[model samples]
Target chain A: MYSVEELVWNDSFINWVRYNKNSDFWESLRASDPAVEENIRKAALIVKAAAATPEIPVEESEAAEVWNRIRRDTAEPETGNRKWHWAVASVAAAFLVFLGIYNYGKTDTRVSYENLISEVASSDYKEIRNDGPDPVSVSLPDRSSVVLYQGSKIGYSLSGYNREKREVYFSGEGFFEVSKNPQKPFFVYSNELITKVLGTSFTIKAPENSEKIEVIVKSGKVEVITRKDPRKKKVLESKELEEGNYLVENQKIDLERATMKLSPIVKRELTELNHAVQQMKFDFDEEPVTRIIADLELAYNVRISYDKVKWQGTKLTAHLSDEPLYDKIEMICKAIEAEYEVRPDKIVIK
Target chain B: MTRLWRSFIAGDEDAFSEIYEAFFKILYRYGYHFAADHSLVKDAIQELFTDLWRLRSNLSDTTSVKFYLFRSLRRRLHTLAGGEDVYQALPLSENDLRGLQTDSREQYLIDKETEEIHLKQLGEGINKLTTRQREALRLKYYEGFTLSEAASIMNMNEQSVRNLIQRAIISLRSLLS
Candidate 1:
């Protein structure tokens, strides 16, 4: 129940009217909420009239020229930046004939790198959707593999990963095994959450029609942030991801569907290792408690506070690979009869 | 918006073309409003797209595509203008004037508003608005940007944008009447 002005001035509704998008839903709304019909009609007319055309917005020849110029500039192998670089290089060569440090102010790749990330992202997307009961498998630009559950779809740009970060749009559940690239992070935008990782594997289940989005990290760490502002409420919004709540591996984050509140990251009780980390095994042969603590610390990137001298000769034989790192620690504590406390960043064993 | 930008950066030719075509007119008109120079506007837009393509691979994410393009166009126009005074040029040429009128809809709207008096009143009402108000109206209504996006383009806060748009709409409606 929006006022006439609000309805007409609404960006998405205007787009809907112009494009006839989501027609059925709007029609049903109008049918149910009859009072807004007159307003809807008036707003539609106003938008239509305002968007009216007398001539092409841009002349064809002019558009052609712009396109032509774009083609020329983008297609050119030896462009202005290169020439400038060469000119600077020659000037340096002539000025400092003697061998000297010449690389200080010679950053020439920056312009091209900037150009690469911005324009290279454009293109038709390769969409992988799973409609049948079976899950669908797809590979990403960074050699990451995704298994989309039934009723799920993922669309990603065709460009292979290079310097740019990898991203994907997922609706419904998707299991991803992303390749490692510390420099370039990979991102997943689900219902109300943006999951970011340098390189890791995880499973995100966000049903298309549902508000709830669950992100569970299997291996490596990921930052899942909820992007919802309580002030700005809209029925449907097609928006880029926002940042806020963060979650890591051996953790699960659930975005409240109704409220769009990002719950805190809870420890992963059932840690499912993805393909990348599946090969890593925590097999040990009567390894000392101190040594085992060190290995576990390295494996999960957590600090373990323990008396190396007291547990120097205490040996334990166990393959606690299947369980999560926390669970493994719990089992080890139980076996060795050691009291332990879990701090935010470290495990203290006494 | 980030996805589109990323694709363009990743050397997706199609994305580049779509972004160019989709934004060209809006950027063109936006630049036109400031300088009233068609060629200048065109060059500014072309340069903007060119620079964007060049730097696509490294551009950060944006929340709104419309806002991002307008912001870029403004920056490009500023650089292209090089401190040259604008708006004194005033009034577009006959050929350039028609550039803003969309095809098919132009005839329809003119026919709908066949009365010269109504057209005059509409024009006068639009002229009555301050430059900022007019720009805000255009960005909000014609360009179909949300208040936030318009605010970003205008370099104003959201509350200011909302007030400007609301005031503009009210004044225009009153003046037209």
Candidate 2:
């Protein structure tokens, strides 16, 4: 006959009692001997009693607050090299002047494009100036691509790029095709406007001399928030061009530089804005369904959820272009004899 | 879990956050069981993570992330407590004993009243064990650590850990009978 301690210390017995694993083996052992069955029952009791420890609750905010402290403690110092320190100081001075012009509405100061370029000209920043007559294509550290129009410039911090966030300061017209990384959001700062995206293609026109800025959404979603003081890093007001809205695609948002007012202007005949859309290729030849869904997810900045194992080895062969995003999804689902549901935050395909 | 650790060592911030999220609560419970100090446990856990990130480059890959974290947290709490006597056995709190009686398997084995009486006796019996015995029982039964892993965590040999758990169960069984 087995003893209680022997049964309690057995790994397979503990697994059976605690996790219901390998019940058949334990059952056969129990039926073989009556004393062993009694020992098994007692051992199971001991395991369950010992495993029933009290739990301590942790708040969600507590985790976030601790992470914030860790992030702050581990952040690199802003001033390191002495030579670059002087350059950063000059850029800070010029930035202060630009902020002064913005806050005071000093048209007499007349901040020129040259002043804007100098303001962002820190040694830590990777500045791209398109001096050629044609638009120059530039690649970001995260593999996102930007088409900088002639006589315009864009700059981003070299240290924090693609690490903490993908941020860039722009004073130009540019078409952006941002790679999808939901963890590190992409932000574009032009004058008072801050455009945030996860992944999408769009166009922004914010010239240093113009009193108005325009943001056109060719694909995906974009959030535009105003910042009164860039030093404070506080958002004043926000607007989002969400997907599924009537004005989602080829929609234009005009921001008055003087008042910082945002108004949406719907114009269906903005045929020139369709260049990026036409450039996207949606032809698939026996591509895996997961890959197709992933591509669509990146292009639209939307989350698509489906049973990966259930759809494993499922392939599609279709040309899904020219139609809207929903229609394209419907066509694929119909071809596969599946159904889809659009949730507020994600799309579910079954 | 090993994949998460590899990515974390490779400086993936998302993977680091995932590791923290996965292990924070259990680590908190383990530390609190010994010290019973809320802020002290919190500080120990925070320091554990901070040190892990700073020393990640020196860390080798490990398949048992839980064992590594638990051992590190225990060592950290030991230093923070300033003495080894902080591990003295304390009686299970009233709520903890109540938790024992509510175990579904115990209910399946016996009636509610008998279960309560037996669990009370078991709780008292468990409290009577040495601190090392109690730690061994917890690591082996509750945390599901294997004998060698528990031995390493407690700085004991495997045979001694097994003997500790054996004596603990024998004493508790006598109390129940």
Candidate 3:
């Protein structure tokens, strides 16, 4: 049977659109056996149900720390990851000809980050190999679990997982579901990249003789860094693999071992634009115009300044769905017969 | 949410902040499932959104905000745990519940049996469940009373008894989630 993940992600399958060129492909296949449609429908519902799992409520206490972190991050825009990625990329691009040993260390933290990862990767660990046919599941001292694939080997602390750090040296493939301990950060050394996590689940596939290493996120965030640099003097220790990326669920990062380049594609990044809030139909039945505009501003995350007191009594019934923000504004303006001006950060209605 | 996300992607500072505010708790609920360590879950959640905001410009458009946050939080937690997805289901069956299923009591149904565990942890978890749910569960599951019997004993309606049982299930699931 076709895989569920692939089929759900396949828009053509979900939408059931068989165009002329590929028509013959599915046509001939289904022509031989017409009963295949049942499997397709069941797969669609299961995939849909996966997305429609009961809404889990996130507690207010749980959100407090995350709120602080995001605010602090976005608040300081200049020093963010994108800026670092760009600066390193541009430097790499500009001085590719002079790409020997250089001291581009002071300005960017990439240098220190690279060294930190290298230092972690080269640490001491006891090795366990899965030569047998069955997958070997290892329980760490701290209770984190590792399922080693056949022919793969992993190394961890020989003295049992030390309190300060939990490290794993892996080659081939493994699935990890690490127990949580905030003090000791978890590190997986796979190929040139080191996957670091505090407490989460993820998988790393580093097959022997393959040009690419794939790290797929099962859950939680992890920082991926390249152990890409060779030994240089104090001038520079190491360089980052194009700044780190945090891959979320249903996302995969493919790193070309040849170039030490990493690229991530998160499912959220490629969604079919499914917004639950936007799906709510808006039919203002003689409601205050301010209410309408307010809801719109809230939904669009835009600011709309208008004389609310004057328009408090104004009421109108209008239905709107799936229209562009500007178009929605235009319709509201036409109904209210109010003039509007588009400002840089907001809209002004008079 | 689409519009907010569009604005966030467009590098609107306010929209990004708003998104953070809107989805932080929801992400937390999804995250706690991976690890029982509350603080660790919180830190992972903080790091997830912080990274998301940092990579806001790079994020692709998404339709399902809940799934997006959920999936992101799961990935974040796993990365922190330094493992693959921890949300794997164990081969739990009614037999595995230590004969809780055959008791024909509603308490077994309420607890949604798992392997035997520590008493203190179970107490802490049971404490979080509501009194109504507990009463309903005990009367219906422990005492082997029918839904209506439990309701009449508790002086409540059958619908309320059903609702109580549902709330109990939800409460128990939240502990795991």
Q: Considering lDDT, which of the candidate structures 1 and 3 is the better prediction for this target?
A: 1
Off by more than 4 A, model 1: A20-57, A70-350, B1-4, B61-64, B82-124, B175-177
Index of the highest-lDDT prediction: 2
The DockQ figures for the candidates are: 0.11, 0.27, 0.12
Off by over 4 Å in 2: A73-350, B88-90, B93-112
Model 1 agreement with the true structure over B1-177: per-residue lDDT tens digits = 566666677786556776776777767766777776778787877787888788876776654666777887876776677854332312223333233332463244334433334334445555556767666766766677777777877677999988876775565445333
Q: Candidate 3: misplaced stretches above 4 Å?
A: A1-124, A229-244, A268-350, B1-177
**Cα error, candidate 2, residue A239 (Å):** 15
Put down candidate 2 lDDT per residue, A1-350, tens digits, no spaces: 56887788788888887777898998788779877867776776677666656556676666655655565455445344322211211100000001111233545424444454454447777889876544555667776766666666888878867876688888767667676677777778777666777766565665566676666655456666555434224321222234443224555566666666666655323343422222445677999987777666544445576666678799999785434456567888998899999653346788
lDDT of 1 by residue, A183-252 (tens): 6666666644566766555666655445445665544566655444442222112222224444444556
- Number of the candidate with higher DockQ, 1 or 3: 3
Better of 2 and 3 by DockQ: 2
Please provide, for model 2 over B1-111, each residue's C-alpha lDDT reduced to its tens digit, 9 standing for 90 to 100: 887799889886556776887887888778887688877877888888888888889888875889989989888888887847466445576677776554564355456
Better of 1 and 2 by DockQ: 2
Descending-DockQ candidate ranking: 2, 3, 1
TM-score of predicted structure 1: 0.38
For each candidate, give its TM-score against the true structure.
0.38, 0.52, 0.27
What are the clash counts of all predictions, listed in order?
34, 0, 35
